[model samples]
Target: MSDNGHQNVTMITCTAPVNIAVIKYWGKRDEELILPINSSLSVTLHQDQLKTTTTIACSKSFQEDRIWLNGKEEDIRHPRLQSCLREIRRLARKRRNSGSPTSDVTSVSHKVHICSVNNFPTAAGLASSAAGYACLVYTLSQLFGVDGELSVVARQGSGSACRSLYGGFVQWKMGERSNGTDSVAEQVAPESHWPELRVLILVVSAEQKSVGSTSGMHTSVKTSDLLTYRADAVVPSRMEEMIGAIRQRNFAAFGELTMKDSNQFHATCLDTYPPIFYLNNISHKIISLVHRYNQHYGEIRVAYTFDAGPNAVIYTLQEHLPEFLQVVCHFFPPEVNGGEFLKGHPVHSSPLSEELKRAINLEPTAKGIRYIISTKVGPGPCVVEDPDLHLLGADGLPKKNA
Candidate 1:
């Protein structure tokens, strides 16, 4: 696998999409191992609107393992990064020792340079870690010519990351094994499983999280009784119901469960000592708007979920998108008139009803949201075949134009 004279360099680029957990994963039994206390379900948003792109290069001449995220170089000694690198190299070595002639032994020993960037915001509680780590593990596998179930390694980077390994509806099973080897993400349904399903991400705030998920989870695990109760008694049944809802395409059930699960997750946060506050005033109003909109239709037309931040992820179907967006616009006026506020699948113009406005009963707040990302279920991480798309140049460093 070593390039001749260490002059040859091997590079691979890949992209992965973000996922919104309807059934939130808040507490972890094993922090360093990143094993969740309960199973979680999420919808993988389309990569076109929200994704992370990563490029990795391996060469014998490189001095050390280095990584750059969203332009700045990040520490490669990060325990999670080391975990992924260690696992991938271990697998490669195992394969070689097993007499697999195709395994690249020389390249496996070479150091690597990784460059990653997110098209969307980072650390703003939008599952950027999920996409980033998924992309990293996938791109590394491609660069080293190693392939198989890498979701376990991805989970080491971020507990939620394992879900990004699959597209559409995914579930992170809280495996019972003490070693956490059984814990892995599995696809509950494909992207085409529900074509009408639509998702709208309300970017309430793009600022970095006041309390990171890792620390918040640790605090919750240490203090909150509610966390233990929910993980032990609540999530198992909810997981089963959620999977059934997706398999049967039951939107109402799915939406209700999503909202309730989100509420319960936040409730656990409140139950924690010193407590974490993920929802701001803006998030509260969005919740009211969603409920009022659903009340107007006498059904669960939309549902909202939050994870470690104030941003709201709304779930609905294609037909309801335009009207719901109109409701959003009425309550939260855009900063710029007719700006490209709505992204992803284009939503047709729709008029807001007087009854709906009265039902919402809130004054329009200018710029409550930075923007809205409209998307739906998307596929898992994919290899980028075009060399021009690579973030690193031939010298194994980020390109200036990248």
Candidate 2:
């Protein structure tokens, strides 16, 4: 609420980081509630590299709810969007009803106008929804003055969005409750837990995904029996072992589990009746490069993981970044000297080896990769205190220059 009067608009802006799952969530136990069939784990990347910035304004003068995503106006009546907005309001009402002093008194009945933008291009096939919905839920909670465990509400927007509520190593526990009350995300370790680790995103294509995650996962649940086995038998023990690996800072164990789980998830996608192919020639080539690179070194120095898209995310230590990056730059050179080559954290220069190049033995594929983002583990959602950074104007509309 604004200090001027009831007619005044109140606005808040926030940013949320993206999370890449090591243990993927491929199926759902319940679609409406967005409950997963199995638990999953992920590492939250730094907000400096990939993130969503959302601004929400509430005012009595607004006629109705409106939303703009990535500079384009969108329907506010979308079912998933409505689910997130309604759940936040309900929590605020419940807190007020309980005579809690922390509940927001104003803007409870005012219509809202939301504007969101992503730092990275949506065409990169990164986890945009994971960051978008998480930012939406976090910003809305700030406006509604509701706190404590908003992951359940965030999950309604996207299952993976729940994991974005925390930083570093996170686990989305598939709770046993039928009502989905206990299905929440918890932090397994903080970002500072592993300072030497780094992430590199190999953008294979900047095209929108042919199949979205929600629809794709639904198909897998219905047609793939392997999904049932992996969810029931494989993920349980794997989750425990992965946690131990993270705790002990064992790169070999952690890297192995990450690669295998990613492979199994894609295998389940193939087992679907029509079969979904998220990996392209570029993705397969990157996988081969990682394998041969590790084989030549006589150790697992790097690992690769893919989601429901062609992009490949590589996990390795900081000491290995320079050499591996040089290997990548050699095979997939940028179009222009400084164009579409790299984004995010910069890596130091290191020369590629002739023997290793011979071992890879693959022809250069020009522009196979759009760019590479070098980053590391980072914190979760954050509020931007600078007033000039706000995306909306006083009239509850997107600013011209935002």
Candidate 3:
């Protein structure tokens, strides 16, 4: 809808959360379309902790299409950005041609100004692009009055983005179609399906990763036999099993699969020619701590998974969060005291037993982790009704403070 007082300008704002893939999507079959080599499952973390907010403003008065990310002007000609813009405008045109009454006729012909910002670090394996692209596609769809199967559009922007279109457990199906029509994300379960599930994101580093996901995936697909084997033989069965575990709410099965898949994904990275390194010393230590803690309890109390960066995402049930968090504190001892060490959702913690600490026994890595983000399953993209939340002002441009 057009913002009041600026009759020629229509603005929309939306927010979307980053999703951590439990079953990773590493390689691509179609780079242009962003079709993954295998289906992957991910949990949509709560937006209160980490998310992207995007605003799209369409105005007939605007001279040309433009974009701003995190307050700075960015080239709108980037292939991925163009892909999403072209697809959304095409869908809108089709809707208008089909005589859809809901289509905004004036805005359909207008150029758009896009502004996007993330609360968390970008390009740091935190799924910032996934949330950003998903937010863009979603906000544009709403503004254009085009709907239905938007994950298809989001996928072209980023392979993992398709999964961010839905909340809770999601699966990005690596479709068999050469055209990639069937390769879209489907929600395995809604956020309500798993109430007790909790997530702790160990922010080992906020800096951009050494290797971007696109380049790394491309290199791995070309050089690693392990990647090919993983795509062909491993992922299919693993996808089905992951879906079953999520539906059944089987913590042990889910946690084990998450950890194993993460390890194997890194192994494939190692198998690549010249190799790619995502995990650092702190990441390895976090993995060890998780395994030792699980061993001490003789169960999968917590499981850790790393993306294309050093940050570790740990999954566990609500009941185990207190002791697990306490264990993390004992081991990684933050430099900042009190609430500054933790960000995002507030978590109640308990002190680890002295015996439990002794059994898990590890040297505390002071300041190894920047902070921990506490979150859990949350909803997908949502339109912000409050115009005050819009990143763009009435002038069809990013607000000064944005």
Q: Which ten residues in a row are the worst by lDDT in model 2?
A: 1-10
Task: Kindly report which residue stretches of model 2 are placed more than 4 angstroms away from their true locations once superposed.
Answer: 1-7
lDDT of 3 by residue, 92-160 (tens): 999899998988777777889999999988888899999999999999999999997799999999888
The deviation in Å at residue 288 for candidate 2 is: 0.3
Comparison by TM-score, 2 against 3, better one: 3
lDDT of 1 by residue, 127-226 (tens): 9999999999998887777777799999999999999988999999999997889899999999999999999999998999999998899999999999
Over 1-402, each residue of candidate 2 has an lDDT whose tens digit, in order, gives 353543478899999999999999889999999999999999999999989999999988788999999888999999999999999998888888888887777677889999999988784558899999999999999988998779999999989999998889999999999889999999999999999999999988888999888889999999999999999999999999999999999999999999999999999989987899999999999998899899999899999999999999999999999999989988887775744587888788898879989998888788888889899999999999997899998777789876
TM-score of each: 0.97, 0.97, 0.98
* Predicted structure 3: lDDT: 0.91
Per-model C-alpha lDDT, please? 0.91, 0.91, 0.91
How much is the lDDT of residue 253 in candidate 3? 98
